[model samples]
Target chain A: MGVSIFGLAWRSLMNRKVSAFLTIFAIALSVALFLGVEKARNAAKDGFDNTISGTELIVGAPSGQINLLLYSVFRLGNATAEISWPTYEAIAARNDVAWAVPISLGDNHRGYRVLGTTQSYFEHYKYGQRQSLAFAEGEMFDDLFDAVIGSEVAKQLGYEVETPLIITHGLGAGGLTDHDNRPFRVVGVLRPTGTPVDQTIHVSLEAITAIHVGWETGARNPLADNIPEETIRGFNLTPRTVTAVFIGLKNRATVLRTRRDLNTNMTEPLLAIIPGQALAELWQVMSTAERVLLAVSAFVIAVGLVSILTSILTSLNERRREMSILRATGARPSHIMTLLIAEAAVLGFMGAVLGAILIQIIFAVAAPILSAQYGVALMGTGPGLVDAYTIGAVTLAALFLGIWPAITALRRSLADGLTVKV
Target chain B: MTQPIVSLSDLSFAWPGQPPVLDVKAFELNRGERLFLRGPSGSGKSTLLGLIAGVLEANSGAVHVLDQDLTELSGGQRDRVRADHLGVIFQMFNLVPYLSVVQNVVLPCRFSKRRLGEVQAAGGAEAEAKRLLARLGLSDEGLLSRNVTELSVGQQQRVAAARALIGNPALIIADEPTSALDADSRDRFIQLLSDEAQKTDAALLFVSHDGALAPLFDRAIDLAEINHAASIMEQA
Candidate 1:
């Protein structure tokens, strides 16, 4: 009466602790689910967008643009054909080309892809806001048999500076494709970039061809018909072809003209694609499903709110005599109405508070596993504008939900204030 | 020279799609007078109280309380009038279960600002509620802190009476409030209610079907003698 209506409503809810807790719990789980999905989707999208920086186009064999982009940058699928080493040299020697990094793929160390590139790859490669690569320990690969592993490869396989590892011939069965005779020393380990590059093993472009020589016979043993490492190194380590090449233009204005020249002027057929544009295409393909997931989570929030409504509605009959007592104590119909609304608003707000708490807990538990599996780093920007809006929307929706029960209580107070049958 | 606290003239009321429940020619309760009206269940006693409290509109004529015509006031205004000038106690389930005994006693002051203002000089609503509860024989320290629902029926009725008298309202209504009490406690409960009313100098309207408890009030009237509609309803 003289006290706050919200206080009265709070007392009423305290009278029924079990139903009130269940209502708030339902809302908290839904809120956590909704925010969790948004965080994961955003993290994945950001990972894709931030993977390649300072590089304009990826050049590969004449094939689909998405295929060329995915195979060259993301290491997703295999290339349709290889770009001859001469063709790579022509692209590198262009007047409009600032620098070019060659890439050869066809092998793996354990499950991680083995990428063959020159020292220029380490110098020119950048990711995540023009960040250059740095070694976690040791230096770049200097010898033909030296290899620098990515952060995830180093961590998962526990490789050290001098650890020697055998490369698989291809993505083949275990023990069969192991180049056990020609194990490469781990010269360095690259720091994590939260990208696909973190899951690769880097070696020199010449080493790819050197390992393939006389290995086409599929020797059953590591020493069977295998030429000595020193002899193969001395016998022309020059590579005949590479899987793809990353072309960085000297002037971004010459991108279109350079691409046209690479397509028509080059002797071998090749395709070039801008990574940013390909990423946009990927988003277009994934956006619909992401929207559906978000909508489903939003529906779950609605269901939680409905439970609030259901609980309040069911309690109305039980509180009839209670309403009559308040009415007899000089509470107006509007007072009864406001008291009921206040109860639900409190529940809604508490649910949102609990939801915020649960989401942070979920993020803390899920962050490491997600980075390890998908390299999607969830940057925890604590309670930004999106969070504010989400909490506000949830509270406002609760206020709206409280209205139905408030109106019902109002009607009862007016119609039967003095004559409550109980 | 003081006006009657409650006055009804040519009042008639009926529920929607039902026969008439109350058709009173004239009823009056003067200032500081305690009046007892005998009306059992289904005898239009609650209907008359509802009209007097301005909770229901009469089909015809005026309901005057605290010298204001209730029929002329808006619903909100009537609610204000009721809060400022009247307090009511029921027969059973008298106390709001969630509130403690002191909070139950101060219930009227929560709605009626005038009552709150009246009790501010007496050390506010809580202190005044404690004073009234002490006077009404419910002064146990442990019982005061207990949940109202856990109190005995006699204790609950005293708490209800303390609540009704807290705001110094011009009129207090006790509608069959002692029917749930045992025969011995019923008389004691009514005596405590009248004592509290006499101390406040507020007109008390005590309605019940129990004729044995009629002698304690200053005036008594049977509903069958005064209410023409009750007789007509009996014939139907």
Candidate 2:
């Protein structure tokens, strides 16, 4: 039986152990970075998709789909117009509407966005497979001044149930209009959903209206500012307007009709958009940035391949004598070529496999940090077909990269023969 | 009636874009003959080995080894002939530094089925390798297990000789194989190599710049007397 050519290749590689390992290490790092970027991108998309998964339609003032999605789901940018209380009630009363949960934004509490909604929000609002929000501690808010904090807000601020926190009138880190007279006590903390909900503080819509009762048109009402907090119960606290409403249709067939009716027949200029379609459109705008990121990562992998070439070419000079020695042992020039190519292939295969393993380890360690920071959950499944393709491509590229050295070695073996000067 | 192990006629070779390096009108080595070829530096000693080993094809004329016309065979066919019928020992690079002594010795068997069969007939390739190493006065198990890098120069040279003698190739080519050994070790190595060649009935073509080792062989030829290209280049 002929001896294994791979056995010869492996022994040759072992002779130059440091260069082989260094080459493998460089390739592994590039693969990890490539896989890491792709994984983060996927996880980010999953987080965005999970944010408002169950809301079939979103109703807000006439605006772009991406704009409405951004302000409604991601809490990005201020709403240009608001839906009045009567309009929201009329929509909620429509026969096609299963539920309409009003969302009142434009408030901040310690850098966390404050979302004011009714008890119906906890009952009807759903995310990530139509799953209802579950409280991690305490129960849903029962009073106008009670607030329920999301997991991230509670964790970041170290707030417990009944921890009093004041609300600021506008969104931002430091808003001048602080509602100091009325502070809401944290009544519940929601479990982590790996969505934007985790970044928001929830309170009753009545509390939102009550907090601004003494103010008029973004300015304070001096006459009511001095009124005692005890007598605030006597004032009317019905919400006048909401930033947007997340609506679920009574039937799947009614979604288009309801969306059209809300846009064309409403008393005010309003727009109703399919949340999924709007999110898709939003993703289109973001895809360009995503493509740029992937391109950069691809260039990084290319650089890694070049390094593989450099490593192999660098060692070819030193291994010239070794090649001639093999020739003297009855190894054909073709065998020398095969040996070099096989060595590169082994390095590439090992580097790719090690990179895949490294990615999983990084995900395992970074999952929590990603959840807490970006609200993205990395599903730690083993390498998929895409990873296999990447590894295969890298291996193939390494083989191509090895050809240069293989040819050089073949030429030197033919030229040098038994009189290898080195 | 037996044919010579090697024969060359009107063999001429040159590097790409250079004048001819070897121009031999005729040369021959009979079976089992130990011939020492001495050449000064730049006298085409290594180039002749290349031609004889079939590693380099002549620009004209025919070179034969064991009745096979090397000029008529493909490059791969030449390699097969080298693997099956010839054993080569270089001045350096005698053993792959990473391979063990036995692995180094059994390398030819790995490439040639004929050689592998010969070793297998003697039990196995590794067994034959050990037997050859034992005859070369390197029988220690510890020495056989060591990486070639850890072996002494004399030990490495012996290992190379054992490798060349394995599978009993019909022809052995030694290009200054003892250049690195001490005087005593070199004499011992040559004696061992001669005995191994005689036992296998393999022709030996040993080339070296040193004339001191020429007395050990059956016959000797100065390359300066045989290669017309060397005299012509010197005159130019």
Candidate 3:
């Protein structure tokens, strides 16, 4: 009996191929959009949350929390004030400090941010909890003049090993101390990390000082030009100040105490923020926008469901004769209702699966672009928990919408049966 | 004498805001009898079929099929009784266009367990459907699996006739079942319906406006004289 009803339903659907296909296509497109938005939103949130999980604290001269997070972790905006190298060294020498990587900012390699830090950065700095830098092609910087480029920088700028690139001394397009005199060679390329580091150009601290050797007190000196490289090195070339320092705690429990101590005891006005806490705060600020996006996607799904109901209900009128025939055959009105409901559920089920597949296709097409533009690495795997939730929710919504049509068909079939001469 | 397979007593029905469409003081069909009901257009012929099949509830008195009072039964029970004891064939749209001929024939068995058991008791329902289709002059190939929409009107009328007799129900109601067919095809359809009714030993109530076909039935009744409401409405 079930088989025959299913066969009847299938044949009925096939009889109106154009209309059925249109309904299914409408549902599939909406499902695809819903899944795509849901995937991107969740991926962005995951990438944001995992940005700096390995590092415990971001230490910088007194600045806003957002600035500290941006500069110390993402290497985005310039630091408002510089922490003296002495302060960085003193903090690094503490017993509770497992490792400290000092960052010197204020340089750019084309559009990519350039960071000057100690070799400890390559050894101890991590993004997603102990995730060390993995070289995709070459080794880390071995020479003071050698540079390690991020995956995005290497790809976008067409840089390879031994590629000579010059650095500018400021963040913007044109600034004083352009540092065109010294050029650095690309020695290594880091693997894609789906973080800001993937878009960075890393150089040794001495390399940073080497490029600015001719500049005296933030200004180019005419007398410094003729001086030999050896003579210029004899001058105090050691950095006087650094932008920020990333500190790794010996014990996870000591982070809060260290943050409090840095806030109160430091002679220099400085702020120390837990990376995870600051990221959560950032997420809180952006959650409203995320929810708005979610609501819009939900609305799209609702519209899709309504279309399904509308199509089914409209077609029910034409189906009156067909349903009456079934009634004459021995089918109860309830049986007719079941057939309609089953057809609707089948449509919803197929739409959800198609939506999931569409998301994978989008990832396949856009992963490379995202990596190049935003350093976001998208993995094309099967549906995850969030994807499953979206599918289940959308399918249930479709089913809910389908109820009206089923009931309408049942009611109309009964009336048609009575009026039918057969 | 045989027991009455269908009995109507003082039945009256009307559309909302209108006078009665049909009123029957008394109507009865004995077992295995073929009765022809003649009526012009809009004489409430379809409504009389509805009353007999328990599809419509009469305003007064009772409609009994196989000694079961349709008015006393619940809606669902009435539907079951209709499925179990009655088979109806409409004029123009008898078969569902999407269903195959055999599928349409086997439809009544799907509703009532009694009808299904009866069809299966003789043979499997599929085999019974095939035999009935064959007897109706449909070829084996035609009976196997062909959509009703593909059939000619004459062929569809034959298929509808086959469907009405498959379960050996106590009564068959055919509402202008041959109106779409040509004269020869109409005569052939009536013969097939009467032969199938005789084979199943079921009473047949055949409604049509064609008075010439009345001689083929065991008894003929003019719906205009039997339905008082239509005569009064015509008089007014």
Q: By lDDT, rank the candidates, best first.
A: 2, 1, 3
> Which stretches in model 1 have alpha-carbon errors above 4 Å?
A1-3, A172-174, A218-226, A380-382, B230-236
lDDT of 1 by residue, A1-422 (tens): 33566778888898989999999999989887888778767877888888888887788899988788777788788887999988989899989999999999978888788999999999888998999999999999999999999998888889989999998888765596677777799999999888888889999988887777767565544454457777887878778888888879989988888888887888898888788888888777788899899999999999988988988999999898889889888898778888888888888888878887888887888877876676566774345566677778888998888889988888877888587875
Q: Kindly state the number of residue pairs that clash in model 1.
A: 2
Query: Residues A25-108, candidate 2, lDDT per residue (tens digit)?
Result: 888888988888887777677777777777889999888888898888887788999989999999999999999999999889
Q: Which DockQ-derived CAPRI band holds candidate 2?
A: medium
lDDT of model 1, residue B205? 97
Candidate 1 lDDT by residue in tens digits, B181-205: 8998999889988988998899999
lDDT of 3 by residue, A1-422 (tens): 21266677677777777877777777777777777776777777788776776788889999788878978777767788999988888889977889888989888978788899888898877766568889988888877778999988988988999999888877766445566666689999999787888899999887888778767477776665677766655656578888888998999899989989887887787799988888888778878888887788778777777777877788888878777766665667677877787667666766777777887887888888887766776543447876677667766776667678878877776655445433
DockQ of each: 0.60, 0.55, 0.41
Which structure among the candidates has the greatest DockQ?
A: 1
Q: How many clashing residue pairs, candidate 2?
A: 0
In Å, residue A267's CA in model 2 sits off its true spot by 3.0
Candidates arranged by DockQ, highest first: 1, 2, 3
What TM-score would every model get versus the actual structure? 0.94, 0.89, 0.88
